[model samples]
Target: MDCLISVDGSVTVSLLKSIFFIINVLFYLNYILKNNIKKMNTEPLNLVNGKIMTLNESFPIVESLTIKNGQYYSLNNPHPNFKTINLNGAFVIPGFIDAHFHIKNLGQRLDMVDLKGTKSAEEIENLIYNKSKTLKSGEWIEGFGWDQNLWNDKNFPSSELLNKTIQNNPVYLTRIDGHSAWINNVAAKVSNFDLSTNIEGGSIVNDCILIDNAMDPIRNSMPKPNKDSTKKWLLSGAQYAAERGITNVHDAWQSPEIIESIIELVQENNFPIKCYGMIGGSFKDFLVDFFAKGQYSGKQYKLRSVKAFIDGALGSRGAALHEPYHDDHCNCGLILISKEEFDELASLCYDNNFQLCTHAIGDRGNSFVLDTYQKYLKAQNDRRWRIEHAQMLTTNDIGRLKECSIIASMQPSHCTSDMKWMKSRIGEHRLHRISRWKTLLDNGIVIAGGSDCPIEEGNPLHEFYAAITRTDHDGFPKGGWQSQEKLSRIEALNLFTKGAAIAEFSENNRGMIEVGYEADLSILSNDIMTIESEKILKTDVIATIVNGNIVYGNKNF
Candidate 1:
């Protein structure tokens, strides 16, 4: 009887093991079927007969590429079942990323009177006068992109002309750098701005011009754009960027409302380009709100950085320099934020793991930023804090950039735009310290290039040309201004690709054209790598693809 019972128990154990084995086999089959279904549902995109620049050292270039599931699937191997587009030997490279940009401002500028390319202040007045005829009485007549440096007189325009030109409308024209404003008597009266009022970190150049903090009162008096209008502006800016071959932009500054609008547009598929938003310090509560919410990392939009101003633009003599300006010997430029305030903000950002991007345009401003960064950040930490427009740096402070792991978020076009007056602003002695791209690179500091759009033309091709040549559109100064600082074609390309990616901590996924990276590409009319420098400006964007979908210039595809 005992022997019979033991044999029955062994048989029971064997039966249980057999059942478990069958369950395991079923689960494995189910997993395989699910993966196969997913693959079947995804429609891959393939590009053939193209000169694709991967920008990856491992696999530098390829002829054909495959995109599946919105990521690069293979290089030089077009999938047989995928939808294919014949490029006919088109030149393709990693999508351009504007490391520093102002999207909402760009949109607003589009609607305002375009003061760009106006030869003189009188021309600006004529344009404003024409725009005023269209608007109703007491309506604000806003204009931008006036550069006194470009004028023959090279002197700041007075409100005397605007006051006389337009009586019914209040005129407010912003300087090219957006740091100064030329307001008429009507605007001053409407905003109750007193000419004698002394403002900290700001200057009232005259009764008409207000620089840095001084422009705030007048700006606040103006009517704010409603939520709908803000959304419209954001869309307009994104569309404009797409047309210019920019797939990604590090939106330099944004209010909470603007950020919400961007997120809404992105979710609804209205935004065409990817944005890495920086919370603006101008909004008092942005940091608090941002900290509570933590960082946002959506597929098309990201928010993890804060933008604060250390000083103002060089054009207005508002950039804080170590010494008095060569032209204006009576004054050293203004400091918008104090060291105490900056350090406090830095601490908050450090604790919250938010990248701090400060607009430091002069040696003094850059020195303050670097010193503050050293206090909060460890040496060589991966925290890529940025100095937007590290336009000028003292010789001693150049090496401190690498030690603090700071990225120079420079706008290449700014160099060309400012080159005309750079010598006069800081004098010939400090000329080598301005826009030191090669010097910074040699010291192991990375540069993330951009357009600072609306201020400049905001064209990626223009930026590339400016970076390689260090010259304006007219190509003055013969062999390029500060020729030693000029970057190579590959270096300039990386500024908008790999270097830009590293600035935003997206280097692993977005910058390159390698397999497993996001399929963002810019197809150009000509190969910028091999073409003559001047011809680069003429090169048009054939196609701009984001997430494997053509967003701009799709007719070529």
Candidate 2:
């Protein structure tokens, strides 16, 4: 007999004992693992009597949800750990995320003079004049948010006038779009420039303003905020965003120093909002090796992406268009970087697991970016190569965005803010393709709604209102700018919540409300899904919660 092969007749006593031991250990491990998961499911942190959007296909919406520690724990399961409160039918949904914003710039702008909403050139001059009076000699007066499009005259102001008005100190006022800088003679001289100061991917418009990269001189000349100052500023910005129901943000542009400051925030547990930072494009070549990719979910700050500007903004006439601007016939707009350079950078980013989010705001610029994205990334791969602002696309490139599997990170409020003047820049013929959000969606491109914030109001509600209505604050144009392209309320909601999360690569954990998901939520004044489109604008964010803890609004509830 083959004694060694037959278990009953020839198996050694020691071998049988070892086999039994191994089976028992695996059985015990399986039992413990299942029990641990069951504990996660049953752990209680209750909130009852609510109208929740949920955003999960299975649950869709729920009246109650239970959370524990930092996660949802269970949906519809009675949680006994916390006191239950009746919400009186206040609508709750996944937390709003401004998918593209400058956290540091927002903080810095908080300290600068408010140049927004100025109707005339004289008002800006007077404001600068007043600001200069408070400052000592040789101090720089910095301001932002002035728009020539909103001015009745609609002309870029000359630096000669700006110099004469604020003669005591140097002045630098950035355009509403942040793509152009208006400087006084003092600043111009300090930066060493004149009307003929020519730089590619930017312009020295009227000798007073520096557009795009040309403003580098002024940027280098300015005093940088230290880590302490950055943390303070960022905290203020976080509180501000929390109040607005923004639970998360994509920090679109952070320098190397700024990136370290964020690390400090994470270490101290001081970062208030979920920060998905992009080491800004200018520092890409230098910082790529400095910041290795995807240290995802360090609790709050995750550097999983890179931001690049392909062109300046349309409002600044620097949005690299195929045709010259209707208003400015001679200029074809600015191309910030060559495609050859972008392709190599994108390849490196891809290998490093970083999402390459390129900001392209014109037809030509968007086309160029889409083409380059196609060149490096395969069609079927789940690479979320994004086009920030993707404001304009040619007829041929409409489906190309979907074919390349790109996410359109759009600022919905840009429609309302820019609609009044869009005709003058791109003309009515190209209007259909501008912010063709509906078109993009129909062809299967994910639209990640955002507010380029300091560029527009960071209110998630305002973004929702603009996206669905496609109208400005006063609700002009009767029906909407490109009424055909307007999105539904639920669609808009998903854009800010689910799409935003997906863009940040946190969709599985953060976007939806269900068991096993994090409890990041936004309670609204009314049910946005069923509310009137105009009432959507009136909808207020009642509360915001991040990681099962309330960050804004009533703590008692």
Candidate 3:
């Protein structure tokens, strides 16, 4: 009996020993799996055999680079354990960043009737008439990219033309600058637009046109895009940007719904490019909510700025100027926001630690914004308050930009586009102060370049060409309009890279191909740095890399 009891105790000990061994084996296997994943996640990606424009003062250029976990790891270093891509001697620069863009509008424009380059009012009317036929009766017919400046008549088209084309549908079309809209009587009646209504900062230019805040009633009456359409538009716009070698965009204005949609896309890993959003001032309630929520900085999105408009576009003569327009003796343009209101807005942004970007196109508009910004911002503080367009400025006010540490967020294309008739609008006397990129740069005031897409072509190449040449696509005016203001090739590149990055407070991690920076790059078919001015427009985007992954094109690997 004693021998049997001892045998049972031995078997019990053996069973316990077997269980412990199995547990140890399982734990070891789990440990191996986890570690393998960790290593894979941290593994480096090497790029070799390329002309890399680092834009780094220290390195400047490199033949190769290594990326680890989506950040630049090292220059001219290749890891044996990681994957390597040969760029085949392509010219690679920091990925282009559009400092100002309208993502939603760009996307929606893709589906709308494109009236760009329409030479006459008759052409636009025909385009709308054709578009109207596709939709059912009463469906809104929307179009964009129409500029009366491009027309031979060079006058605002009467709504009677649209009325003659399609009376059954409500037609709404926006001017290229987006500061004004031309609507038929049908749309005006639908929006309950009353000509007698007193709009403080807007004007109803006859029955056809509404300028600035005057168009709000019509816009509010329009149906808002639902979630699905919003998502589609955002994705489409982002893809369009990616294709253009743009990896980051500072969306100039965003609604709460659009911002939420962007967040959702980023969370789902559906968004391919990084977006820095500036909440629209129109959304007052959302601004209050966002201030309470503080700023959001994610892998692919950020929201920390608010965009306000002090005036309108110069093309539409809605930009508030100190003196009357040369073309219209009695008109000095409109001020969208009064100085008192602007001051209050500035206080809100300053107190909430949000960046303030104001649209100030004319001299008077710019002065008002500069004064308001000075009241809230201390000298040499890093507020980074920006004057969008900064189109027209007085000589005295130029120094104020430096005093306030303001960023001149100018669109190079605007200069070229407006050169055709800008002199007639403001006269030659004030021309020197318009889009003074070189002067602004010399004064130690940073100038961030952008296309202001949907208003312009939104192509980085176009922006670069326009900046350096100060000419249109055809290279007009021989020596370039405002030749002294033209930026050098490298300087032009910096406007879209370093300048843009600095504006968004991402210079340390982006804008340069330095070690430990984000692996964002734009590979071009030709060396834009050495290419001829006219050929710059012909240059093709070979590949656009964001976070060390190819998002658009795959020429080499």
Worst 10 residues of 2 by lDDT: 34-43
Cα error of candidate 3 at position 377, Å: 1.5
Candidate 1 error regions (>4 Å):
1-42
Tens-digit lDDT string for candidate 3 (155-215): 9987679887888889889999999998888887788887668788888776788899998
lDDT (tens digit, per residue) of candidate 2 on 82-156? 756567778999888889888888888999999899998889998988888899988999999999987888999
355 in model 3: Cα distance from truth in Å?
0.6
Choose 1 or 2, whichever is better by TM-score: 1
Per-residue lDDT tens digits of candidate 1, residues 193-212?
89789999998976889999
lDDT values of the candidates? 0.86, 0.80, 0.86
Instruction: State TM-scores per candidate.
Output: 0.91, 0.90, 0.91
The reply for model 2, stretches above 4 Å from the true place, is 1-44, 291-296, 554-557
TM-score of structure candidate 2: 0.90
- C-alpha root-mean-square deviation, each candidate: 14.8, 13.7, 14.4
